[model samples]
Target: MSGTSEGPTPATDLIQPNVTHSDATPCPGTEQIAVPAAGQTAAAAPSAPSRGGPDAPLPATGGTTPMAESAPAPAGFTGMDQQPSAAPRRPPAEPPFRSAFSAAPLAMAVVDRDGLVVSANDTFGALFGGGPEEFTGQVAADLVDLTSDPRIRQAYQQVLDGRRARLRCARRLKHPDGHPLWVQITVAPLAPESPNVLLSVADISARRELQDRLRHVQNHDPVTRLPNRTLFFERLSAALEAESYESGGSGRVGLCYLDLDGFKAVNDTLGHRVGDRLLAAVADRLTRCANEAGHGRTSVPLVARLGGDEFALLVEGSTGTEQLAELAESVLTALQAPFEISGRQLSVSASIGVVERQAAGTSATALMQAADTTLYWAKADGKARWTLFDPERNAHRMTRQALVSSLRTAVDRGEFTLEYQPLVGMDDGRLRGVEALVRWRHPRFGTLTPNRFIALAEEDGSIVPLGRWILATACRQARRWQLDHPDEPPIFVSVNVAVRQVWDSDLVADVAGVLAETGLAPHLLQLELTESAVMGSAGRPLQSLRALSDMGVRIAIDDFGTGYSNLAYLSRLPVSALKLDGSFVRGFQHEENTGENAAGQGEEHDGAAGRPSPADEVIVEAMVQLAHRLGLTVTAECVETCDQASRLRRIGCDTGQGWLYSRPVPPDRISELLGSRC
Candidate 1:
C-alpha cells in the first residue's frame, strides 16, 4: 500500500462533499483515484506534490510507508493505492479554483443542462438580495429575468449545443427586494464534456443610466427640454424620405416658421433671464398646441426652437394647405395670450409663414428657405398674421432681386437705353419736346420697362448712380440733336426724377456737371417729378428744386391732380408746366350726346356736357386757368385719339404726349419729326 499525507490539502478542503471525481483503475505505471459512493466514507487520498519541484517515484504495491499500517480495511476497493518507481510520486497541487470562484467580484452561478442553478457565488446572492442557498435549485432563467426574451433562450441553446463557445448579453434582473438590476450576462460551458454552464453577471445600471442621459442631451434642448434644431431637422429629413417612399411623390408636408414680434422689446426692457423664461413659457404653449393639433391622429407634428425667438413646426403627411393654414392660425391665436414671467405679464404676437408642398421633389433646404421667405411675407404684410407661400409672388420677388443684382453692372454693360416720346403741341399739332424713357434690355428678360426695376433700385439706393447715368445720357443725346438741328426751334427733352434720387443724391451738382459736360442748355433739359413727390418736397428738397429752376432747368410736375395739390405752394414754385395725369385726360374720350360731333362742331359748350364730361371739362378748365394765372404751361398726357386732342386743344392745353402722335421713339425718330416740323 502507498502512504498518503495526513495533512489536509487546500484543494481537497475546497471540494464540496457533493462534488464527485471520476474513478478509474490504475495501469502499471500510473496512479488511480476513486470517489466514494453516496453515503459511503472513503480513506483519504495521497496529496499531490508541489508544482515545479523535484519528482519522487510512487511507491509500488506492498511498499511500506508511515501511513500504511493505519490504512482501514478497503471496502469495495477496485484497485490498491500504489506508486510507480519511475513516475513522479505526487502531482502538483490543483489550482485554487474554488477560492477564486467564491471571492470573485462578478456574480457567478453554475447552471445545469436542465436550466437549474446548481450553485451561486456570494456576489450573485448579494446582487439578487439572497444567500447562495436560496439561489440554488432555482431556475437559471427565473433568476436572470431572461425568460421574457426569446433570444436569450436561443443563445443558451446554441452555447449548450456546441454551436458557440460563449454567449454574452445585457439583461434586466429582478432583485428579491423589488428593485431592478441592470446586468451584463456572459455564459460559457463549465467543461468540454460537462452538462453544466457558468454564468457571469455584472451590474451595469449606472452605465445604462449614463447612456440614456447622453442620448437625451443629444436629442433635446437644455433650456426648453424640447427638441432642438438638430433633432428637428433630422426628423424632418426622415419624414420627407418616408413620405417619398410611402406616397410615391404625392404626399404633402408643411412647415410653419414663427418669429415673435416685439420679442426684442422684452429683452431690451427686461433682461435676457426674463426673456429666457418667457421663451420657455412660449415653448410649453407651443408643445401643448402641437399635441392638441395631433391628438387622435396617427402622425404628430414636431415643434422645435430654431434659436432666439424663432420656432418652427413641421407637419408630416399633411392633407392640404387648409390644414397648414389652420395650424398657423392656431399658433398665432395661441401666442395672443399674455405670458407671465417673473410676476410680469408680457404680450407677444407671432408672424407665421406656411409652406405646404409635395414631398417627392422637395428637399429640406428648399422647404426651409421657402418657409423663411413666407415668414418674411407675413412680417411684411403686417405682423400678427400668417401668409401662405405663393409661387407667383415669390417669383416676382426673385426677379426683383435678380434685377437689383444686375443693376450695378447694367450701366457699365450698356444694358440701359433711352426711348424718346414726342411731346406735341395740342393746338399747333407739331412736336414741341420728347420725354426720355429708360428701358433695360436685359440679357435674360427682354425689354424691361422702368416700372419693373425702378422700385427695387430705389430701395437698394442703386437709383442714384442709375439716375446719374440716365441724366448724363439723355442730356448728351439732346445736345447732339440741338447741334444737328441748329436752324430748327430747340426741342426740350424731359427726364423723370425719382424721389430717392432727389433726396439722396446731389441733384443740383449732378445736373450742372452733366449739362456742362454735354454742352446742353439747362432750359432745354426738363426734369419731371411726380405730383406726389413735388407736393411733398420741403426744406432741402424744395430748395434743391428752386435751385435747379434758377439754373434755367425746366421743372415740371408729372401726373398732376393724382396727388394732394398744394396749389398755394405750387403757385410759389418755379414749376414750368403741369402734366395732367392720364386718368383726367381719359375723360376726353367719353363723348356725351349733347349734339357734339367728333370735331367739336356742335353747340359751343363751355364746361358743359360734351366729349369731355361737364365735370371733367370744368376741372380741366379750372386747372388750366390756375396754371395760366401762375404763368405755367399745361400739358395733357395720354392722348390716344384725335377727339381727345381736339378736346384738350379746346381746353387751352399747350402740349399733348401720347401714342396718338407717336409712341416714345428713339432720338433719330425725334430728329426726323423735328426736321419735318421745321
Candidate 2:
C-alpha cells in the first residue's frame, strides 16, 4: 500500500484518519476515490482543467487525489506541460441519493433485515448523542426504544420483514443530559422490494404536553381546583373494576355522596355568587377530610364536585364499612362549622350517604344509586347527619318502588280481592254489617295487606281505580248475600275509602251507580273514611258526603280519635257512624293482676295484663254518649275478648268489630256468618 515520494501515490496510502474502507483495492478497471475528513467541507467550485490532459478537472483541495490522477504514467513526466489524447476515466460517481440521505433534515437511519443499523444520517447520530459511524452495527430496536412496548416491537418486526407497509408510534425517551423527550418513531421499507427499512423519529414533546394540559382542564373543576364529575366517575369506574384490585390492593371501594342541606335556599336568598363561594368552601373542607381519611394508607381519596352543591369522596382499597362511616362522620363534623362569605356568617350542613362493598361485582352506577338513596334517608331522618347504606333498607325501598310501579297494573289485572270483617251489634249480639278490606294478591310478593300498598296507591293516584273496584265488588257481593238469605234482614257492607277517592273522583256518582247496578238498597252500603279525611271536610268532599247521604248511603268515620278530633263538623256534616280506633278498646280490659298494687308494682299500664285504665273508660264512654246524642251509631274496634265486649256494650257502643267476633275473612266466609249473630 506504500507509494514512492517521486511519483503519483496509491489512494490507500493517502487515506485520512477519519475515513476507512473495507476493501484494500478497487475492482478490475475501477479507480479508488478518497473522502474528506470529518468537519471539513468539500470545495463546491469545479477545479481548473489540467494542462497535460484534455480539460480534466483537478482533485479536491486539501484531500488526496484519485488513484488515476496520482499514478505516474508509463511514458515520461506527463504533467502541466504535456497534453493527452483524452481525459482519464474518472472513478464511478458516488450514488446521488446517498449524499441526499446524509444531508436530509429528518433524523433517519437505515436498518437491515437483521435489525442492525447499516447506516445512519448525521442528523440521526447527532440526535442520539453519537456520530454516524458510532451507530453502525448497533441494534436499531434498542436505539429507538422500540422493544420497550411489545406492540411497537411486533409492528417494527413486521415492517423489517417487509410484511407490513409502515409502523408509527410515540415513545418517551430520556436524553443523556437528564432531560425528557417525547418522540414519534416511524419505520417503513426503503422500497417495495428493498431489504432495508428506514426509521425516522420526530420530536413531539410539545404536542404531548399540550394534550396533557387540555385533559387536565377537562377533568377538573375550575372553582375547587379538584376533580369534577367526569374524573370522579372515571376513577370510580376504574376502582370498581376487578382489575383495579388485582394488584395486591384491598379489593374494596367506598363512596360518600354528600349534598349541602338547604343549599337552594341560600342560592335563592343570597344570590348564586354567595352560594358558589359557600360550595367552594365546602369543597375545601371535604378535600381536607379526604386527605386526613387517607392517612397511613396507600393512596389519598379522590374528592370531586359532582355539581352545584353536591360533592363525593371516593375511596379505593377501602378497609370496610367502618372506614366509610368514619369518613362520612368526618365530613359531617367538618361541615358543621360556619362559613364566612361576603362578610356574612353563613351556616350550612351536609347530609352524606356512605356506601362501601367489595369491588368484584359492583359498578359505579349501582354504588352511586345506593349512596343517593341513603343520602335521601339521611335528609329525611333529619339533615346534618350521615347515613350508612343498609341493604335491608334499600331492599325495602326497592320493594316499595316495585309495588308502586305495579299498583295500577295490579288493579287492571284483577290482582286485588276483598276481605270482610264483621261488625256485630253490641245490644243484640247480631251481625250488623261487614267492613270491607282490600288485599293485593301480588304474583311476586304474595298477599300484601292494606298497610303495605294502600299508601303507595294513594300517592300515585292508583287509589281512585282501586277504590271504585272495591266499592263495586263489595256492593255486588252484599246484594248476593241478601238474595241468599231472604229470611235475614239484609246485612249491610261498609267499605273503607281513601280521602283521595273523594277529591280525585266523583264519589257520589260512583256510589249511586254501583247501588243501581247491584240492585242493593243504598241503606245496605256504608263508606268509611279516616278521621283525618272527614274532620275538616269542605268543598268537593263536603258536597260529596252530603250528596251520598241524601241518596240513603251511610257515611262513617274510621279510626276515630286517632286524628285531629274536631267534633264541630259532626252536627253539620252527614256522618252517621263512628268506628273508634283499636287503641282505645285495647285499654278497656279486665284486670288480671288486681293484687299488683299491694306488691308495689302499681303503675299506669296499657292493660296488657292489668285492669282497664280508668282514663280510657271515661274517654270511650264520653265518645259513645256524644255519638249517640248526635244520632250517630258507635262501633268499637279491636275487641278481643268477651270481657272487652261486655265493657264496650256497657259503654253503649252500637257495634263491635274485632277478633272477638271474627278475623277478617274472604267473601264466602262472611256469607257463612251472615245467618248467625256474634
Cα lDDT computed for each candidate against the true fold: 0.81, 0.83
TM-scores of the candidates in the order shown: 0.72, 0.83
lDDT of 2 by residue, 1-678 (tens): 111111122222222222324455434433334443223333422233233354445544333232255566545434642324364523333334555666778888778799988777777877889777678788999987999888899998999877899999999998767799889999988766466788888878899999999999999988778899999999998888743559788889988998899889999999989888888888889989989998899889999999888899999899899999999989889988899999998888999899988888778888899999999999999989999999999999999999999999887898999999999989888898999999999999999899999999899999999999999999999999999989988899999898899999998989989999999999999999999989888899999999999999999999999999888888998999999999988886643555665365655543354566789889999999999999999999998988888888888999999998999999888778877877
For residue 582, model 1's alpha carbon misses the true position, in angstroms, by 1.2
Query: Model 2 segments beyond 4 Å from truth?
Result: 1-100, 103-105, 129-133, 161-165, 175-177, 242-247, 590-610
Please give the lDDT score at residue 130 for candidate 2: 74
Q: Residue by residue across 72-130, what tens digits does model 1's lDDT show?
A: 53454334543334455443333356667767888888777777777777888889887
Residue pairs with clashing backbones, model 2: 8-70
Count clashes in each candidate, considering only residues at least 3 apart in sequence or on different chains: 5, 1
